[model samples]
Target: MGADRGRRGGRPVRVGVYVGCGALLLAGCASMPDSGGLSGVESTPRQDAQVRVFAKSPSKDASPAEIVQGFLEALTSDDPQYETAREYLTSSASQAWDPYRSTTVLAEGPNAEAVHSGTSEGTAEILYRLSGSKVATVDTQHAYAPDSGSYSRTVHLTRQKTTKEWRIDGLPQGVVMGRTDFQRNYKSVNKYYFASNVSSETGGQLETVADPVYVRKQVDPMTQMVRALLKGPTRWLDRVVGSSFPTGTELKKGVKSLSPDDRNMVTVPLNQKADHVGQGQCSKMAAQLLFTFKDLTPTGVDEVELQKSDGSQLCVLTEDQADGIASHGTAHYPDYQYFIDGKQRLVRMPSSGSDKQPEPVPGALGDGDKKLRAAAVSRDESSAAGVSTDGTSLYVGSLVSGGSLGEAVLHSQGKTADDRLTTPSWDGQGDLWVADRDPKNPRLLLLQKGAGSPLVVETPSLDGRIKAVRVAADGVRIALIVEKDGKSSLQIGRIERGTKSGEPPTVSILELRSVAPQLEEVTAMSWAGDSRLVVIGREQGGVQQMRYVQVDGSTPVGTAPSALTGVKEIAASEDERLPLVAHSQEDGIVRLSSGEQWQKVVKDGTAPVYPG
Candidate 1:
């Protein structure tokens, strides 16, 4: 659903199911190579010595006028040589288009006439008109058939400017096929060309002619525009990745010498530095996106940031109210601020739009509403952790208002104005998945809003606390990180079609021992693919790190220390290899698309806000 592309832009109209009933007309249009500008009539002419002489036969030796007459005669006289009409056309005209694929020369009137004139370019133009009993053929192999309707066609013939020889250039410009009314007795020239590949059932469509070539002409500009638009929510980035970050901030900033594959840690010289308020006690980790404001210079948007653990410097700076930061409570308004602890938190920025009530679709919730209520009562938030993609309504988590640990399902889309889930993650499909901790059980319960039943998936081990849960594709798999025993572990599970609960449909647990040991709790979890996961934050070393782990067996497959020095926040690009890192020294965004080709898109010290 997220990958859907836009169709043609125009006024919507109800089209009939069947559209092949209209009469097909013989109209002419032209296809020419991209030609350079033509000179004035007085420009020197280049001689064309390649013209072929006609044979002595009466039909072959006919002049341009006679040749046009013969073409008209064959259409109405039913002459046997009609099939061999090619014998009379000039070699240039015959080679211009594939007769088998070109005009079928259907029916023409016996009174058809050809008018010829010479142009300044030394080409003779021909206009042919006919009506009644003209010869026509559907395809090359088919015999000419008699037809009744009268029709007209205009053709262009170019003579070698120097030799005064003529040849056909086919259709003229004004008659090409396009949108027009069918009721009128007008003939529109239409051109159709097709190519196919066996690898796919359908072939891609490409226009033979496109106006304003600018659309496809500049590749670099288009690439930059697309990259900028896809730079997701910016406000959230600033929240998570702050200005002054620690040395090991997973997302780092680099200078002109940055590489393509360096994921974490960027280096910057003081002279060309970003606006850094010096290093903070917290570990800064950020994923920086090279961006440009609509009216400003190039900048980078940090999507995720891991601030230092110490309390000296504030990791997030935003207009969001400060109180919401301490209690994990709802923001007073649309934007708010807060601090992040050791737990891994995935924060997505809110989109641009007015504050409208969430709308609820009756069937969208399925029969799970009741189950959600029963299950939410056991958890504790007053507001549901998830909502539909439409934003029409909101779902209350099992845990709300510090209330009793029982299952409860509350709707906030229209009724409640205050409490709403913070940092919600969507499954790419329509369903939203949220994380809720169970007081009695040490496991984290995943509250799903769109499933048939109010759904919940708990971590296998009750010893660890669940911090984050991410869904892949359309609810196919759920990836989460659990912090237990001062260590963080990654968990993967699949959703079963009919199951209600207990040991989720299919589950696998992987502990993050390699990255951190004592306080090695996971800080962030991002899914690069179904089998791959990227985790940020540190454990024992006090140094922030970005680890790429394969979920198949719960182990680390690769690790990249952000070359970015003094990192603040780390955000991963859609491509797993390229990680954007923010630096603390100067307000800068370093892109690690590779280990060698590092480019700084934003050098401003503006820190992005993450879900605190």
Candidate 2:
């Protein structure tokens, strides 16, 4: 249930994409090599097994040292068959290879030996020595069974008769180690050692070593002290201030005596506790820290903002978004509030008082009894469907699902649910134009301020498919896509207020090939200026492209398609010099500002555009 709710809020809204559950088919392995089903070296099964072990075991293990050598050699082999020395085991080894088998052997004596063993079904049992190079005894138990007897095994380094050499091979039920055991063994081996698997339960595995650098296997007292002071929360402030001071000792009355040069160290944290010592002490500490450049930055701010501060605008440094406020600081921690400067860098601390305001709530989108046919809003949330220029009213078209089209209404202030309009899209001036998608008699509905029974202009049969419909700023021209004969084409119409022209509005076909021969269909169309448009679509070769078209009822000057290939979305700026185009597969938004020089202004996931 939690996952379902998360999907609703965290998942992207799919306007044209459909998602569904799927299944993955697992193919069975090829039939085992048939050697007449013999039992030993002659049979394909038995030979394959022994061959696998031969591939893994080191060439020599004649002595105790050879056992460690053999173990290291086995680990170096990346291939599981070679790494496991599987062929060396008896036929019963098949049971040991199953993944369901998860178990470890922890034996402590003079040797303090520990071993981990587990298998991933028919695959292999991977193991490593957790601690104690020398072996004394081995204890093994199954992960699925606690009552199972502990298998006692011994290591016997012997020479290979066939190779006429010594090697650690053909040992039965040997112990090995895994990741979990590695951590356990590391701590047990070094009493002073502290290590943690940084891996998340569902993510990748990482290991952090404390007190000593475990990998290089080196120990440094001073470096370890600094690392602990920096990361340990409970003892952090005390350890840091203590080490920096010379012969400092705690005194009565909530104070500590320190050397003159190190006095500032204690003063910094004390100044922060102003209520206990008074504002005068806090100000003195802040001033001192600033002058010494210890922890306080020159901008009179802490590293991060205060907790629970309200009404903070989150940073969104994308090309289409608003710039950050000046004289403020940058925020890195989650849910933090800070003030930043014009360069988008941290500059000042956020106001830390009770006057913090609440995040503003948008006005409720009124939903009336009127039915909605279609709706579209501006990409930047700058305008909604059918909003008035003054932002006081809305143009709405109502049609009941599976019912006849209803009248277009211009809605104003109201709390009544029955008074709401449907299918709202606005022009540059807030004049909303909607469409009644009546399969039988489709119509273009218009709503303007102070208008009643909206001006409905009957439209041609758009077959059964309508892609998109939007209006120009002047509210006199509208652009839409209508499908006929299973093919879509761009259609433009004139929208006149209160005029029953008695005739269909003038329509024109936007032929991209005639305009730019390489173009195919128009997937997106936006007005570049008063009389120009920016269209995005694929070319005849199925390569996505962007073209600029001038629509003044005259021949247009066709600029070359965007030099940047694979353009999926082209957002024209108020100045055309910086058109932002998004590439879905490349997962980056590039600004075409330097004339064919594309700069990756925003990275992927800022706002992901679904690929077609």
Give all TM-scores, in the order shown: 0.28, 0.28
Model 1 CA lDDT for position 149: 40
Could you tell me the TM-score of candidate 2? 0.28
Q: Per-residue alpha-carbon lDDT of model 1 for 76-108, expressed as tens digits?
A: 211222333444345665564353331223221
| Candidate 2, superposed: residue stretches over 4 Å from native | 1-383, 386-425, 436-443, 449-455, 460-465, 499-520, 539-542, 552-569, 573-578, 581-591, 594-612
C-alpha root-mean-square deviation, candidate 1? 27.9
After superposing candidate 1 on the true structure, give the runs of residues whose Cα lies further than 4 Å from its correct spot.
1-422, 438-453, 458-462, 497-519, 553-561, 564-570, 577-592, 595-612
Measured with C-alpha atoms, the lDDT of residue 146 in candidate 2 is 13
